[model samples]
Target: MAIVTMIRRDVLTLPAAELGPDNPLPPLRPLDEMHRIEDRDKEDLPGDMARQIGYAPLHSLLPVRVRDGYGRTRAPRDIDTLVIENDRLRATVLPGLGGRIASLYHKPTGRELLYRNPVFQPACFALNGAWYSGGIEWNIGATGHTTLSCSPLHAARVTAPDGGEMLRLWEWERLRDLPFQVDLWLPEGSDFLYVGVRVRNPHERPAPVYWWSNIAVPEECRVLAPAEEAYHFGYERRLRRVPVPSYDAVDRTYPLNSVHPADYFYEVPDGRRRWIAALDENGHGLVQTSTDVLRGRKLFVWGTGTGGRRWQEWLTEPGTGGYCEIQAGLARTQLEHVRLDAESEVSWLEAYGPLSARREGEWAAVVRGAEAGLDAVLPRAEVEAAYAAWRPCADTEPGETLAVGSGWGALEVLRTGDKLPGTPFEESTLGDAQTPWLQLLRSGSFPEPRRVTPSGETLVAPHWRDMLESAPAQPLTEYHLGVAQWHAGDRAQAVRSWERALQLSTSSWRLLRCLAVADREADHHERAADRYAEAFDDLCQERRDDGESWTAATAALGHEAIEALVATGRITDARAVWHRLHPATRRRGRFRLIEARLLLAEGKREAARAVFDAGFEVADLREGAESIGELWARITDEPLPAHYDFRMRPGHDDRPA
Candidate 1:
């Protein structure tokens, strides 16, 4: 084994002899057959791994080392030694163990990173050792990471030598992320990695699944993205809950929450890989993954900020931690909802990128096996116009940025008069399973007898009012109430309701999710992040391979809420709900540009450029310059015509309207 040691910031390479560059090629296996690899193996194998034997082989094993202008290694000195051999690569510690490996040839920019070795490497085994047997392979760009990995079965796996570890991989297999193609490429010399999860799935059968990635950061450190609209969440006194805020921007330099039990979900879309990099923000030589894009995948970032002074600022409390995973991914058990099937192959998901600290780039996701025609997708123009129209009215009227909401939207719903009625409280005695909360109330169990009487002018509903008032409330109910409030125009009341709900339910992943919604509305991204993490755990458990509540009625409501969230630039949050909720909840949009608008918000010049560059992408309105046009139209009752004299654009046509 090559022993590479570094006391400085220079990059180092491991010798071939020590790296076992000539080890027997991994047996050719099919993508489906490799699903045996476990998450732990997936994390440690390529980087921070000791033996290359665990990884399977590709068509070629080209070996190379990374260096800078001075012929010095370009990677961080602390990053053990990274060795790339053809399609297979390995990393070993100078004085430690293993490290992360990057794809040598195929790299995609503005998209989430998905190392194939763990999922597709071994799949070549079943193809008589042919790496691309029944699969398709294409190059993204010179510096781009490998982006295309599709399977005949829509499933990929990774296994250990002794059959110890196992993990499964699936994407766009069932027509989910759709109407667009997965474009993974990188701009050479850029400091950030760009990846995107496109949508190409047909609108016929939308499939939803809980999504997340298990990311392993190279070092312990702080995350420096943007706090202008951050939604922070984490354990409160060791409880799994989150807090939601309203239009509040945090000024802390780094992430405030510690890294003990790290996890979260973003309300953004999976779009062009934006700024997903591990920068030593504090110049502490720390590495962190900026994005973990899994449509419906939970987001988890765990690390110790308590170790160094830079980190300490982020984590002010005693239990402030680090040294673990600045990571994110869905829990294993939550994999049920995500499935590989025929009708679902066309369902697509789009994720946005972090263009700037304050905003993110959007993604146009397409289904897996649907037609390649452009008509099947949502155009970029509509997305821009929608964003422009959906911005908060206060934001549109400068000096009008008034306190309009509590975190949850309850007040908004009540004030706007769009609040949906919760189950009637008088029906609490109806325990026939034919009514809502009948079983729980009949059995005197939790979340039972959801109902409430209208006190004077206040209308109370079962899941809404009772759940909100109950000592141990129901997160879903709070979210609904907040949604109603937002619809009703009581924005400030909704924010307050959601924020209060966040403090009440720490163990409830549902609460975490509600917090995400409220945070997004209030424009408090830090708090939204916190709630997203908690919701991730719940999402995993709720949806998996084995389907559970697929009823039409429940699905419809879920779809409506998800669409509303997405229209407002909460792509990640909408995706999470889409994955967990049943088909009834899936809403097929005439145009999907919420993600692109978010990219504009992040200040990703390239990403925004790409959105505008796409011949089919155009915007109709200029949403107060603070929002995208498409997003604005979708959210509020605005006069966003299909075409406007001021660079008017079509809602669905990528061409300028």
Candidate 2:
């Protein structure tokens, strides 16, 4: 049977704000206040390995904008989805949402190979703030999650090497300024679905590259990789080498063997086919294998802990059971960023299918059977040959535009007519976000949108930075240039830029907020609070209710300003900022939490208790954040609800009586 592809409607609920417009402000929090959640830092040892781990740690996500505009409300809306199907398998892709393969269903077995998240609930997991769970997530860019986790990608039909139709998802990764594509197809009479990935650097500079195909699998399986030693990183923020399959006298290959969240990056040695499988007791589960260049394989288990279970529940709806990640990446560890030199590309072919049941009994036997099963389906030699076959196909132009992604790539290509053969970020794809940049590209000047509003974007790419630097000076220009400079780690120049921007427009709340962030990072809490208060007040002073897009900015500034005031023990000032918020904005879940914080700061335990009693949900509450539960316990004489208990540490959770 021939492969078929079509766009269908899926109810896109759970991402309440419709994965709303990105926060106009850059997403960098004060470094001092930012808890280092990722534990990819090297362990202290007397070796060059330790030195290598620190080689190019991403200090900041400067060029990329934060995606925090999505909220927790779950209103249903229609979203277009591209579905590709064959007689044997069916794959559903969300081009509007990071090109996530939302489902891979086996027709013969009637099983969902990947975790099919019933809802699109986004949490604060991506490098950008909003990230949802389940399916196959293609993570690229510097560590953590990709900024594209919730963003759309350019999707279209392309001719496969076998003359079949394939769905291609391409996007310009502005974080690294690289164009990449993922071509997915299922061959006729073949059980294994083929995925060809290519990332190209059109620029003349060495770019740090990271790619990980993270597949969410059910926890009711044993994850087997081609390594006996694994780098284990747990919630305590420590990386230690431990034995795979069995670590600390427990066989951790089973996802339930642990009690906390952890990453087991397998040490897939040289000459080994890079593959990992999550096989059930009967050795029937999903197997993912790729060619040599996509080298790393890993198993990320949230473990059997309550926090882990709670996180699983939070990402989807409660009672979705649990799932772990079996990932394939371009590096041994997610912390390590491989260098893709100037004008080069890296391409690989990956195959994913159900591992045939081996009828093995022991765990060791089941693992070996799993490996043998993969070899039977798609041998390493065949995978390498598939990579060779897909090389010329990588240059195949997209046939029909199935969906659209961001216009960042089109904006870049417009600036420097770089021709990427296969993935064309077309001129027509340029949207409102790219309009300002397009004017800058054509006129070498940025439009100023600084009256009672924040700049919609704060891109800090070297080219854009240089463009802004040479543009006619304005408050917006100076403010954006300062952001670029700050991201490039030039704090002094960044501060000067913001200060000058403020000089041009004294009441520009955006400039004040940027300066306030600089002060906060420098540990000047009082000064930061003062700046934040001024910024919030300035925003309020310039409101025109006739309908301007100031509500998001006002709420954001007001939230930050109140938090800063409360943190610095200025209770009255915090209350003033809170009340200054638009009534509609104040009624939102996050602001209610802020109101509680304000009451708690003023020694009003009863008032704080009332705030919780009033029942509010902080929609964008991050994973493992126990702040709400901690606050609840501190004020109210009641046990923390299961809803707010997001504690990931085993013993630190606020369990109810």
Candidate 3:
């Protein structure tokens, strides 16, 4: 029989903020009260454009105390961990963290098939920030980590047909206003773990539905899949193309030996088998094979460099080692900008387990073995037999229920109708702050400044202020309030709020940078310079502490700080900061333009011109080259070089650069 049970264990404890004397759990404000009229007016527009308008109310406005990277401490806390076991494999799930698979162990070799992060360390990696590395993160509704990534999910244990055990986790994806469920089954004596996923849209209108299972494995592993080309995204989301495995005179194989990091999304050849595997040099690794429901495959590489290592540390911890991700998506690519029709549901099954191969050539053989074994073990007759022999086990809890004889092992999931305590945001009530905020956040658009009502009569500011007042000590609350205040043209008050936020959470690079921007916009040049300098220093410290190489985000922040210093006539300080940037960042066209500008300001026209010439020769410039070239021409009063190509590159379409 499959073993399934839930246990609470102390893993990681995060810093907790104290709520004021006011009630910690306040009544959720209705959506109408929470959102201004502008939010509703923009509802008819496409989802992606609406999110950009920034009309969504900020639900995280409530203050919660959290410690900085240095001051934070980790302790054990009781979190429910679901354990599912069979003769060949054992798996664990953390229902509290979006029902994320915490561990998948192959009992035969006693090796972990999935990377299991020992600690619950969160870093500023996800779109909304606060992403934890390792395991499989179920991303639905919008790209990056979904709003539910770090949130808890409803869970249950049920007896599958044929006495097999199943662990089910379900949650309402507020951003998409849909419900998603995942069922994991481990039949007795089977080597593979079966994962069935269902996403339902009960609404009347069609909406975009995105799903990606992000699976992490050890760094330096080779990923085997059927793909001919891969799209690479560089700093600032620059897109490029190269052949899969070996491309563009560079080896694109996994567990890369290259000095530079790589981030790319690959589309599988149409009609190819839906399978991907990451095998170490020894041929022991993890394999994920899904039904036709999942069609896209992706590979992300964080090179073995100082910057990459530091990023690894931030996501996990020191000495825990780094990992890479092999992702599977439902659409042709990630969040394919598509929509799901109303009152429809999409479901699929995926199988995952350990794959053992002793040599590189045997990788395909291993995959074949897994495929054959799956077919043999879970044939239609076997499934029918299992369904007929199903019986409730003693471990079956009351909250967990089961259905039999459903097509393709389908089970009926009863919504718990339970509201998550303490936060009104996850409640399904239309009037709750989450409804409109989620609608805006998921749409990828925000209202324009002119569309919003006058700052004095703003609808969201008062609610944010109320939350801040109720949790005066929470830094995040202050941060949100500062954002609202800034939008209201209260720059001074915004600065004050941001300053308090920084004081409370010194390690928050986002807060520091926002404060710096506010200072810069307010014409407080020296203050802005100081803030930028401090932020840069913090980034450097993190790099040093984590042994990470320079990242594009940090480099961009550094560039901003140095520019601020230069603006303040602190050329010497700017030079020091510029020199400290990584060599690769220094070679970029954007930084070169800044360098030329700096040289021209210092009255070295020839040096500036030489810098500009060199930059134009080597840098692709992508989309930004024209603007930088224009600025260069303005600075030097000279024409752009004849050889410089301002036209877009073949693979570099208008993405983010």
What lDDT score belongs to each candidate, Candidate 1 first? Answer: 0.28, 0.79, 0.57
Candidate 3: global Cα-lDDT? Answer: 0.57
User: How much is the lDDT of residue 479 in candidate 3?
Assistant: 62
lDDT value, residue 491 of candidate 2: 91
lDDT of 1 at 629: 46
Task: Please give the lDDT score for candidate 2.
Answer: 0.79
> Tell me, what's the RMSD of every candidate?
27.9, 3.1, 14.1
lDDT of 1 by residue, 1-657 (tens): 322211111234421111111111111111222112244434532231212223222221111111100111122233232221111112111111101222222222222122122111111111121211111122111111121221121111122111211111122121122122222112222222222222222233443322222333323333332111222233221112222111124212233333222333232234622112232332222112322233222233432321122222222222333322222222111212332233333222221221112111211111111111211232334333322332221011111111111112222222233312210112222223223333222442334223321101111322334434453445434544554454345657666666666666443444455456556556776566556545554545543242222132223234334545545566666656556654322222212243344454555545744543352221111111223344444343455333221221122223210
Candidate 2 per-residue C-alpha lDDT over 1-657 given as tens digits, one digit per residue, 9 for 90 to 100: 444543344544443346765666676663221213333454443244454345565676666666656666777666667887777788888898899998888888998898877777788888767898888989988777788988889988888877778889999997788999999987776777889999998888888888999999988887887788888766665677888678667888888877788888898888987888887776678889998889888898887666687788878777767889999998777766787889999989999888865633565576566678788777888888877888899899998888889888988888899888998888998887788888888998998763545567778888888998999888878888999888888899999999988889755788889999999989999999999998888878876762435777777778788888888999999899877778877887778888887887888888888887778867777655678878887787676776666677656643320
For candidate 2, give the lDDT of residue 533.
90
Per-residue CA lDDT of model 3 for 329-409, tens digit only, reads 875444253457877777777778776644345434644564454455445344334323432222234244221111100
Model 2 CA deviation exceeding 4 Å by range: 1-17, 30-52, 359-364, 450-452, 546-548, 636-639, 653-657
